[model samples]
Target: MKFTTYLRQGAPRLAVVDGGDLIDLNDADAQVPADMRAALRAGADLQAAGRRAIQAGKRQALDGTKLAPLVPEPGKIICLGLNYYDHAKEGGREKPDYPWFFFRAASSLVAHGEAGWLPRVSSRFDYEAELAVVIGTAVPRHTTQADALGHVFGYACFNDMSVRDYQKRTPQWTIGKNFDRTGGFGPVLVTADELAPGATGLRIQSRLNGQVMQDANTDDMIFSVAETIALLAEVLTLEPGDVIVMGTPAGVGQARTPPVWMKAGDTIEIDIERVGLLSNPIANEAA
Candidate 1:
């Protein structure tokens, strides 16, 4: 089932997506938490709750609803760089043996339809369309690939926006990747049951102001979600609400002949077939 976190009275409220409407999960079942992160942590059968909500909950029109990040306050937000072969080649790098793991602070999260800030510090703002994995169960160190996916809860589209200058200033890409409100993170969350295992084979694309910029399939990723989870679990505990953003494909602004940076008033969209679409407007950070 598709789920979303929308704003009501300036507070985030979880809902199950229905035809042209949203069913308030908490309103349907007092047992269900209003927050996505809390619901994941609570370990309730969200799909079941969502189904119940869709059948007999408070219904509200979904059109033009303001949103919040899928997991508004994720426990951990891990990301990978150059996880796609074409993307690696475009950046003049060889295929990586291990995923270039990075962390994004919760503050970097921008909900779908929100403005993606173009920092005043530099003009190299760019976009990277990525697949976001939301952890459902704790994955302990040394978890095997076979068992890795079992811990995943759902998937969402993410725009891993970048400030290229800040990214290259240091060896670590976190500087540019962690800009507040740069990470576009929602629209809807599709439970793992609704898609292929590990969410492979789905088409992923990015469009800037109605023009396609990046296009690829999830199968193109060098590090599969299960593999990434196992590898990451080896380093640290992957808890509920922890997010793993599988890297982007080729066609990022920096790879173009004339780098295409996101400017104010531009709308950037990340669309993952079967998962969802995450769209955000570009705006000046200093404004």
Candidate 2:
């Protein structure tokens, strides 16, 4: 089942998307937990109960509600970089010996359709269209590839918007990637049972305005989702609701003939086949 968080009277609440409308999970008798983070912490029993209510059609869809980040405020937001051969090559680097990872603070996350602000600190803001895995279980060190996927809850489209200038300032990428409101994710979270975690062959593309900017397939990932998960699990514990942003394919603005950075009024549409489209507009942070 697809899940979403939306705004109602300036408050954020969880809901399940049913067909064209959204069923308010907050209205279910089970007392919709505080948020997705809380729901995940409640464990399988709570999630199962919520799913049953959604399937029973006991919820109501609100009118004129706004979409919030699918899993707003995750416990951790880990990201993979240079995991796409073409992206690595575009950055003038060789194939990585292992998955190169980084972290994005949960505060950086913005909802789909919300304005993604380009910070004035760096003028080289760029876009990265990626597939993000949402963890559903705690994975400890030394997990196998086969067991890696069992920890995933589902997938969603993520835009790892970057400030190339700031990113290259140091060997670490967190500085450039952690800018507030730069990590725009989710129109909805497609559950694992529906899409099968770690399954490749899905197409991912990004558009600036009406023109395609980035286009590729998950099959092109140098380190597949399962591999990345298995590798990360060896070091840190992967808990439910922790997010992993599998790096983007080639075709980013930074690699263009004369690097094309995003500006105010620009609209970025990240579409991942089977998952969904996540679109946001560009705006200056100072504005």
Against the reference, the lDDT scores of all candidates come to: 0.93, 0.83
Alpha-carbon shift of residue 49 in model 2 (angstroms): 3.7
Tens-place lDDT per residue, model 2, 148-219, is 888888889999999888898999999999899899899888888787458488999999997898888898
* Residue 157 accuracy (lDDT) in model 2: 90
Q: Which residue pairs show collisions in model 2?
A: none
Candidate 1: clashing residue pairs, number: 0
Pick out the ten consecutive residues of candidate 1 with the lowest summed lDDT.
54-63
Question: How do the predictions measure up, each by TM-score?
Answer: 0.98, 0.94
Error of 1 at 284 (Å): 1.0
lDDT of 1 at 50: 89
Candidate 1 per-residue C-alpha lDDT over 1-287 given as tens digits, one digit per residue, 9 for 90 to 100: 88899998999999999878999899899998899889888898898898888878888887799989989999899999999999999999999999998899999999988899989898899999999999988898999999999999899999999999999999988998998899999899889988999999999999999999999999999999999999997889999999999999999999998889999999999999988878899999955
